[model samples]
Target chain A: MTDATPTFERSPDLPPPASTVGVVGWLRQNLFSTWYNTLLTILALWIVWEAVPPVISWAFLTADWAGTSRDDCTSGGACWVFIKEWFGQFIYGRYPIEERWRINFGSIILIVCAATLFFPRFPYKLWVSLFLIFVYPIVAFFLFSGDAFGLEWVETPLWGGLFLTLVIAIVGCVFALPIGIVLALGRRSDMPAVRAVCVAFIELWRGVPLITVLFMASVMFPLFVPEGLTFDKLLRALIGIMLFQAAYLAEVIRGGLQAIPRGQYEGAQALGLSYWKMMILIILPQALKLVIPGIVNSFIALLKDTTLVLIIGLFDFLGMIQAAGTNPDWLGFAVEGYVFAAFVFWVLCFGISRYSLHLERKLHTGH
Target chain B: MAVSSEVGTPPARASFWNDPRIRAIIFQILILGGIILFGIYIVNNTLVNMESRGISSGFDFMGRTAGFDIGMTLIPYDEASSYGRAFFVSLLNTLLVSAIGIFFATILGFIVGIARLSNNWLVSKLAEVYIEIIRNIPLLLQIFFWYFAVLRALPSPRQSFELADTFFLNLRGLFVPKPIFEAGFSAILISFLIGLVAVVFIARWAKRRREATGQQFHTVYVSIGILVGLPFLAGLVTGFPLSWDYPALKGFNFQGGMTLIPELVALTIALSVYTASFIAEVVRSGIQAVSHGQTEAAGSLGLRPGPTLRLVIIPQALRVIIPPLTNQYLNLTKNSSLAAAIAYPDLVLVFAGTALMQTGQAVEIIAITMAVYLTISLVISAIMNWYNKKMALVER
Candidate 1:
């Protein structure tokens, strides 16, 4: 005694929920749904208003973007003129005037190679990156140091500014990674004696602050060397930074190594590969891949730590600024100098972190 | 008693070339020998070079007078103080800044972390900007910015910016009214301490009651009342024995009040702001790691939002939060060494910088300084491990 048949027509689609359909609805739900949320929204807007406009006006509207000296900076705003006047020094440091072209060429090669390496669609990416990793440093060293290419010699002491910072960061990472891998392996080795030595070395470096290490290198390293052999302060700082960073990198690498399944090791052994060959060919590739984000993070940290070299009398990028800030010629522009330095560091670090995040997402193996 | 009585033939002796155990021993011995010989060679060279330079190395300089004046000291110190006292004073200063930094940073970090998770679009975005900007810049630069660019821009002590007429800010530093304890003040202190203990007991009792009888108690209000009322009552009985020592301009600088030097202020602010960004990320991740299913389950069980967070979420989230939080604290402690950059007279500045420079005992001074940091790290990690275990989940 039910109805003979049901209606075949579809029910009309209702409008989407009112709280999520439009911009106003979105605003209502997201910003002003509750009284407390509304208050927070207003406070946030006020902060933005109070902060952004002043910064814009100070940095752009009243900024002195022209002229060469401080006289051009009459406006009550940022003195971009001062930055421009010392821009050359900021980039080339105390490198000889005739030899600035070598630094420029070196930087140009670096930028081009880096751009090509990171370019997603670039051909021969592997070979290019390999070249960058292995050969470019040697070539760049000759270009910067000279005396081998019929170019004038530029001492390490003469290196400064962004060039020196990049040098330290790149060289430090390159040298540290292999040492870190070795130490990480040693820490995980079966032999107790090797493990103990590795543990002591890593901990000894990790326990102290980087500054004391630099101090030791500067003040005590000279005493450790034989007579008639002296280390450049820059060399000394590099060594100190390398040892310090290797400890941190070893820990990160160790974490990656630990993530590898014991089955992987067993498989490699079953293939009859020797221990070193197995690690080199099988274990490390996957472990390093897993820890790319961590490695990038440590590299960023090392890049920032290079500024500590200023304490060792090494005139790196930041050291140049600290020195130039005190210069009688550029008095009262410490704020500008520091702001520039901060901006440079922020950009580099932020870029590296963003890349790391991207790599992390891309390399999600779901293990 | 159940051991097998069957005897088996021994395996053939393995050759040394193919033996893993023998190879390991040989490898270890080689490493040990190399390390020792290299260590001796370096030591010999260092000693010879140091002697040639006429710079003797030992920790005996610790007892000698420091002669240098520290910018800030927690304990009494002067030019006449021994190097040991100076070291202690600087260590205390370091701990003081680190403690203050950690306290404020945790509070700010939690607020920012929660704000980041706020449904309010503007609030979360603003929090994001704060974290990104603060975290990207180096800590040393941030310290310099606060010290030279912001705090140094303040008016001189003679024209100090007064806050509530009790706190003053100037180029010299921040000056706040010192709390002066007078006769019978110990009574109020004792009452406060008693109130704290009572609150703990009340909390435990209330929790037990809630579990046993499905009843709720307003322990928060009760505890606050007890804490405040007991202190007030004790102070009244003790004739209100607290006074404020106001700072006054006697000459060029302020006199007769507690002064926090600009260096300390800058260092603390920089450390707090820099470290708070990191802590904020940790806190946000910790809270986020407590899955939404847990909250849903709590809600289905008739738990309100506050109880769901307090009783359900926080306990689990804290397990995730504490390990990283401890790391940030240790990092802040270590980063305090950057105080040497601004001449804040921290342990590094006092012991490693000045003490070493004066005595020319690089090896000894740096060793002690490094040992102190290592010890601090070890002790902190030990405490953190204990706390983590206490907070860890109990599973079969």
Candidate 2:
């Protein structure tokens, strides 16, 4: 209780010791913290040293970039000239040179439509999305096929390379979304028969490989239809892709549906909303938003799986590369072709995943 | 009297269309009717079309001769083999590649997963880069790259890459010295199995003793010693009855060794590497899902880091990891079908590709191929479910 006046002045804080304060400190704490860690650090450094420089020198420093033929690639390094020589074939695979602009125009419109969705201030966001989802596909199809718009008629066989890959992936996803939603709803329906049918359909597709599905579509589909009722090869493959993708998308949407709180359903029901109205107006918007990342991931998967169309004899981007690699003139350029394809695929997949992550972050609202 | 009257009065009945129960039944009936009609239409059209094309359909074709050659097969096969036998051979090939891929992928995945969570920044970043780059590339592209670009670039057999005079790798394939087991080799195998049984028993005994006496035993070290020593002793007693058929360079190519076809090596490597990236992500998320408080609590209980991880963290993490790990395994199995693209003689290629082409029995062959894959998927998932149920938390 005594108010004593005996006091001591406090010393100002000193900087942390050198071993715990800077780059060396970080290295000490993170890399060389223990015997095993130090060993691991050395091993990692060894791996990097063994791998990085050779790759860099081969890929960049010694690569032949500005050449027009196989003979122009005499550097004993990567011959990017091969990729350059076949760039047209790789991008538009035997697509008539004059008619390539249609694909370009369609892609530009798609990009614009996609871009509008990202703009928060856009007034016609919903309309733009609907057009991209519904109307743009038919327009793009007509533009590419050229039978309806007075443009030059390019047969489906000529649809190859990245253009065909984009078409299959975009159309597959755009069509699969509605089908998947319906399937998801059916699976969760109160009606026993509807649920059973949906379950059977989903499992039938999910349990088998896509290769088999494509085989069925290509070989068996002809028999399934009446005689002389020929479908385009590309159309058959697209149908196969859509059915396969819808099953996976249905599962993902079901996950979203399950995640939605039961109270939301009760509230909608309490407000005298019919099941369809409740779903369209209240339940679906929230559920779909919650699973945007999942949807994008599935889209990325569909894009990758589009390569399987090559087995059915449709030359997608990978297929084009495979065909070009086996060309007699470009015999030994498989390495370059594959590397380029890998780079393109990596960029696209990485970009989509990053966008998904961004959307997930933006849409995340705490309950 | 008023309450009784209210309870006794029946509610007003809505129209049949407005009744939810009647509507559900009607909706379901409509869907069922549509499906049935569609099925009948398809079957009728298929019958007529097949008759017109002269394509007979049934499983009877499975008994006919396959009349084709497969590059790599586990069982003895030739052109005279029945289509059924060819199916099995290709199925075994598919299973072989899948098993090897799963084995390697699991090991690589666990390593990368642990590395991603490493304290070393460089290691984690390196692991991250590996996962990102490998995950994005298509598996088929990777297979083609490996087979056509890398393996095909290897020197011819005359100038093959040799490893310690036992392994030879060239453009044709990878050649490893095949083991020649002598008559007494079964003794060593028997001893190994016996040692495994003994270790299990010893483990149980040690656990019981520890519970009763409050004492610990080094069961792991003891089990390892018995497992290795018993096998070694048996081998020594049997005069080490084993020999190696080294892959020596013959006139035109290497001989006297097991040659793994380039197609298989390529497909296996691609499938494993791609699947490993996904498994690594699953493993990382699983370990992350194990709360930090668990680690701290273990530390407070006087357990070291390694034991804390093995005894506490991994068990819980595995509960999260197993389901997704099963999914990746199923994915690897399904993706193995891509082997057809490279003409690897897998089931899809042998049965669905060649057999269907020869017999023109597309419906039967494709259905069988799909059924095989579906069966495999179901079996794996069933096993996974059993494991999950066994590992599920026990609540009082």
Specify the highest-DockQ model's number. 2
Candidate 1's C-alpha runs over 4 A off are A1-20, A119-130, B1-12, B196-226
Which 10-residue window of candidate 2 chain A scores lowest in summed lDDT?
Answer: A1-10
Could you tell me every candidate's TM-score relative to the true structure?
Answer: 0.94, 0.97
Q: Which stretches of model 2 miss by more than 4 angstroms?
A: A1-7, B1-8, B208-214
Weakest ten-residue segment in model 1 chain B by summed lDDT? B1-10
Error of 1 at B352 (Å): 1.1
Each candidate's B-chain TM-score, in sequence, is 0.93, 0.96
- The Cα local distance difference test for each model comes to 0.90, 0.92
Tell me the DockQ of each model, to 2 decimals. Answer: 0.76, 0.85
Q: Best candidate per TM-score, number?
A: 2
> Against the hidden true structure, what lDDT does model 2 obtain?
0.92
lDDT, candidate 2, at A77: 81
